[model samples]
Target chain A: MSEFARLEEKLAKLRQRERIAGEGRKLRGKGGDALLAALVAEIDETILPRRLSLVTPQGPVHLAVANRRLQALLAPVPGSLPEGLADHALPDIEDPKLAELGQSLKTLLAEAENIPVTARRLDRAFGSDIGVPAVQLPRIWTVAQPTAAKPDDILSGFLADLGDAALAWLRIEGEEVTLQGGEEAAVAALSEQAAIFLDSYFGKFDAAYREPSLACGTVIAPADGSANAVFFVEIGEFSAIIHAPAAQMPSIASDWQRRVAE
Target chain B: MDITAELDAMRVDVQGCALVAYTDLSSQLVLSTSAAANPVQEEMNALSQAAHLALDGAIAEGAAVSWGGETPAELAFLMTGAEVRLFLRSPANSSEALIAVCAPDVDLERAVSEARATLARIGGQG
Candidate 1:
């Protein structure tokens, strides 16, 4: 056969292989069909333009199809061989299943195209954080303290300073006061000052109160000769504790007043 | 007084949260509360921080280019995927920041519209 005829024969074989592959893809899943469709689309839209080239052991043999599979089959033949001899070495006739597969693939692609493109919606709205449980605040307090101030009074005071979301917890230890709150940093700072005030009060009044630093910067105030007062603060997810001498409670309140002013 | 409820609400709307919280950022569990069962909390918090950073960066640059106005950008890592977008622009009167998070492949137009609405709701402009 002439060189042109030989090239045509090879092209026919490649088309047959592609058809079979396309059908196998359809049998697999939607994903497979999608892939096959994409490949066929590329071939139709892009690959057909001057795509084919043939080569032998020595050099290239320019053909009408640039398909890689077809080129690979022709690659082993020596360049000096005549077109007729090259044609004789070509693979057997194209598989008949290819046409059937090609028809099914075409039908599958048509169905996929006809399917409506629905708007993708999430069952639950997307959030940077979702379904995750709230964080657990550390257990840094030991006991609750009695206060002349009501819960509303304390909450209102905290709200005035740190928004409505603030919270406070108190723990009492022997001759020591600890205060904690949601605003850990601010509470910590207050705790440190409370401790200072308690120490100073005990020094002046000759009272006894425990000095604890386990809660960072929390003040332990001496409420009286036998007990101490502690304050806790929490602002949203943040928290802090303050402990001071119960005997020096009045002084600690005055200090808070002064700091708020500043 | 209900800090947990308030935080839950804030988490629903706030963009780019950067908390110096005493609790784990992932689980959203307040460290002050007693510990409980939660396997994915840590991973969630880490992802939130990363998402916040990504959204912040996008907003820092004007939304028109980075976000592709009609369609927001999608977040894709080796294992996880999410949708996030940012919009920062000068309003008719002032300058403000706008960031939004949506499911993967969220429509850009809708995200931008919702972000604008959120900013308005929160007293932010543009």
Candidate 2:
């Protein structure tokens, strides 16, 4: 059966209880220890609202099931969950449905960030040691193919480690978020070329954007698959280039899709 | 390769695809298209133009024509939480490209690889 179908069957069985899928509002239900357990078992972290709270004899019991192994979101409250007939806040489930919740992904695009910029390839290299100044632009690309050296391990396991070291100190002033570093200006300056590319190829996208959601740096295949590139997304307000192991893209992509739905 | 055959196969080849088009970027027009749902003409034109600029425009001038370094300049693909667009520019005719639309959950690597292969053969008249 389709994943959605399975989830549907599980939810249907619990229809006896109120299902509050959206928020604040409470959805009620009646008696089904096995049903609740079954529903949690099938839908892993791939789907959100994966956690549902049951109003029980003890109080509101939160059920957080992930990776098919019940984690802290575990419930039953040790005899607190009296013989079923409890309320569940199932907001956004009826209106959007589990299938409708996100763009529905089948890729490994784990995390995506929409950093402010006109957009330029800022290939920074950080020294393994802390307090070391990270090189902002590592490679020197020529106007024509002059055999310039660009790192082939582009961004692989690198972004995850960058937070270990800090190139620019962060401070907050009133409502303004500030990064203390001249590198910010350099990255912005590099956007001039990127701006040109954005205007020429990927047209600006106007959406319900919280921040800049236009522009993407591109990379074509037939290479070693190590070089990083960006995709100018045509949907929603998000604009980011995803970097992750190709194999894990689907689950990660689905996670991103869920966020968009939110 | 049969363009229609290739486009039709995308239904099974790539999950969640809505439409596929073979576009002549020189004119930013669609030569042919295949999809379960028909999008408006304006959408197709926009996609065509986007494909043209991505591969043939000024940004392409860098890295001496191929997509910089060892990367091939045959394909450009992006997926969003909203829509997924994949463009493959034919090496035979720089202006020719394939535009594909799919849902966010699609296997993007497969989409690009399949589209790139089709564009490559489009010139050979396979």
Go through the candidates in order and give each one's DockQ.
Answer: 0.02, 0.18
How displaced is residue A128 in candidate 2, in Å?
40
Candidate 2 C-alpha lDDT tens digits along A1-262? 1312332343334322322122121221222322232222222211222344434333444443222222222333324333231222122223222221111110101121211112111122212221101111011100111121111111222223323222221111111222222245432322222233334333222211112221122333322333323222222111222322223333334333333321
For every model shown, what is its TM-score relative to the native structure?
Answer: 0.20, 0.41
lDDT, candidates in the order shown: 0.27, 0.38
Candidate 1 CAPRI-style tier: incorrect
lDDT of 1 at B32: 20
Number of backbone-clashing residue pairs for each candidate, in the order shown: 71, 32
Superposed model 1: Cα runs more than 4 Å off: A1-31, A38-262, B1-3, B10-46, B49-101, B104-126
lDDT of 1 at A167: 31
lDDT per residue as tens, model 1, A1-262: 1312332343344333332111111111143244233333222211111222211123433221121111111222333434333322212124332233234333433333322111111122222221111010001111112212332333336434543222333232221232334455544444333333333222321111011111111122221322334433222112233333333323333333222221
DockQ of 1: 0.02
Isolated chain B TM-score per model: 0.32, 0.78
